[model samples]
Target: MTQEKYYFENPKSSIRSLTEDEIEAAIADYENGVKISEICQKYPKLKVSSFYKQLPYKLNQEKCEYCNNQIYTKVRKNGYGNDLAKLCIYCNHDYTKNCNCEQCFHNTNVALEEKRKELQIVWKNFYTEYYNLNYTLNDISIFDEIYLVLLIQSYKGTFENTLDFSYFKQLRFQVHASSHEYYSVINNLIDRKILIPNIYYFDSYDYIYSSEPSLPTINSTKINWIPNIIKTSGTLLSVSELDKILKERTYSVEDKKILWREVYWSEIKSYIDYQINI
Candidate 1:
């Protein structure tokens, strides 16, 4: 009778174990709109909390609703007072705003304005030098031709198809014996600061005309280029000259310098063409 009192051990375990196939099936059922509780019920061994833990990893398999981008499983805060929201890093959007969810627009606008100002300064300096070179070579002789070729090639980093030096020989046949002489002149010009080597290429024919050598004076000095134009024409020469020319037809030292470097070179060509026939 005592021997008949032995009991059988329980086969069911507290810890639930699911195979890879079973897990995939659970995920597929949840994706098909089945509730987590229902999934647990169907699995019998799967706990409710355990199903929620698997939910994130499983739901991340789907794509984002906004940009059709892949959804990321990691949750992040939307902003102040908002709960953690799901977002696609590729096309981030806060669903609450009802806008294309992205980072703050204010920051983006500020960044763009700063970049625009920087680009404007760069272009202004580049154009100023270009105009200076055009004025320096009033008649465009062999020296001017070679200088221009080197200048363009220097700044642009490489020679463009538009630059051709064959015309220099046709002009009065006074061309140098060889092009090497032109290179030597350019090298001397670089050393004298009349030309600045290309900032990009350390060792090459690339060079930019320098404005430093022709800086204008601040006082009402000689009629060096700019004041001459203002005196000849009753009208103001440029925007910088409008105030000075209208008030006294005289420019402060700084303003005169700026006018000479930035505007005089471009306007000088037209002024000279009108004054002289050659």
Candidate 2:
């Protein structure tokens, strides 16, 4: 016979562990509104998630008085893509059957209501930021107004380039003016070189607005369109030109020239102050 290795002899127990009846009594104490931490203090082996599982089962057992069969098990279903679960029961007939009890209905409704409240808070923040940025009016030039309106519309990714007549009508009414007045303001901006028109052939709008002023076709290969804008002397500027100037050093000769041509002296001082603070 081969020799066998032994570790240690098992000792016989004199003291007895808690029986199933004792466990049931502890569970009853938990069901009768005893604090979980208190129970944990008494029984150090109890876990939190496991303790929470008992409450729902105990509550369901009391609510489900119709069937003599113990609710052997309870399962939760996806609450229609919500942060909630649908209470279900396993009966003697089938494991797949859902509980259509009144208590289950009430729980589902309450959960859905709570979810709606959470969603409303999220939507409130979104709308507040959107309205602050786009709707609230501040001291703005006609050029800035038109640019902002177009930019917002573009961001929405809905309306076409063609002006929304309804929006124009609403704005006209709000300003206590006509479409002609709005056009006149825009025309002044063009004359003052505040709003530079796009030169692309495809962007031409003859029906609703005045024809874009004639501009030299950009020589993409030979000349840098941006730097050329800084060099040229003209009343009307282009968007591409402005973009280029903004990219260079703020106090550059080109920048000063552009500022001298476009912005007032006080405005220039304020701009300098703002840039310094930033």
Candidate 3:
């Protein structure tokens, strides 16, 4: 007998992709409690694992609490080196500080202006007492009082507590006043003996008093005899101390007095008392 003829054949199978409709159907069936093995049998071209990978799932993202806009979150550290709160992506707003977005800028400015107004009231009250004690209350003008307060506030503890003449010029721009107004205030303060010429640069008093016939004008002029640096007869409070005083809610007159130079407080109190009695 002839040897039995044997034939072996290998069948080629191509992967058939599932359409969008087929994928949707599979996803629906899978979500409806259909077994993975059954679904794989139904679509044998792709594995159940592949089908599961294409399934939809909920995303882990955060939304802005204010506007419900999508925001990215990041892990930040706090002062103690711990995890901080989530920051808003749009406004840069966080739990720690105010938002920097344009929408929030108006509120921030309003808050700052309110704070400035409050501080102004406090400063006005604080300096009004000082102004009344130093000058005759009846003769005191709010304009002059404000100028005196501004001068004291601008004190920077320069040489022998002297301030540069240029600061007076700059004050005109700061308060939207004319150069004449600022200089006039300075002249008044000088004539009242509040601001004294810094005589430390002079070898003797004769140079200032040398019968040169000084003509006082409120406006800036070309005068060679004008002093560039001026000082107050009494020591002025330092900027840092004034800042501290401004921050504190309750500061006594005694506390304010102590802020001055130790040597001047007694004399200041004595003068204040004398003026009060007068």
Each prediction's TM-score versus the true structure? 0.22, 0.23, 0.27
> CA RMSD for every model?
21.9, 20.2, 24.3
Clashes of each: 6, 0, 0
Cα lDDT tens digits for candidate 1, 1-278: 11211111222321125655776676567556577778778788876664433432223455666566555442221123323345455566434454445553544556656654554455356536743431122232333334443433332222221222234334322233442332244333333333332222212111222234333111101111111122233431331342232434344687556655544554565577556756
**Among these predicted structures, which one has the highest TM-score?**
3
> What lDDT does model 3 reach?
0.43
User: What TM-score would candidate 1 get against the native?
Assistant: 0.22
lDDT of 3 by residue, 218-262 (tens): 221111112122124444433343334334535457745544544
Per-residue lDDT tens digits for candidate 2, residues 155-207, read 21122222222233334322223322332433233333333222222222221
Task: Extract clashing residue pairs from model 2.
Answer: none
Best by lDDT: 3
Q: How many clashes would you count in candidate 3?
A: 0
Error of 3 at 82 (Å): 4.1
| Model 1 root-mean-square deviation | 21.9
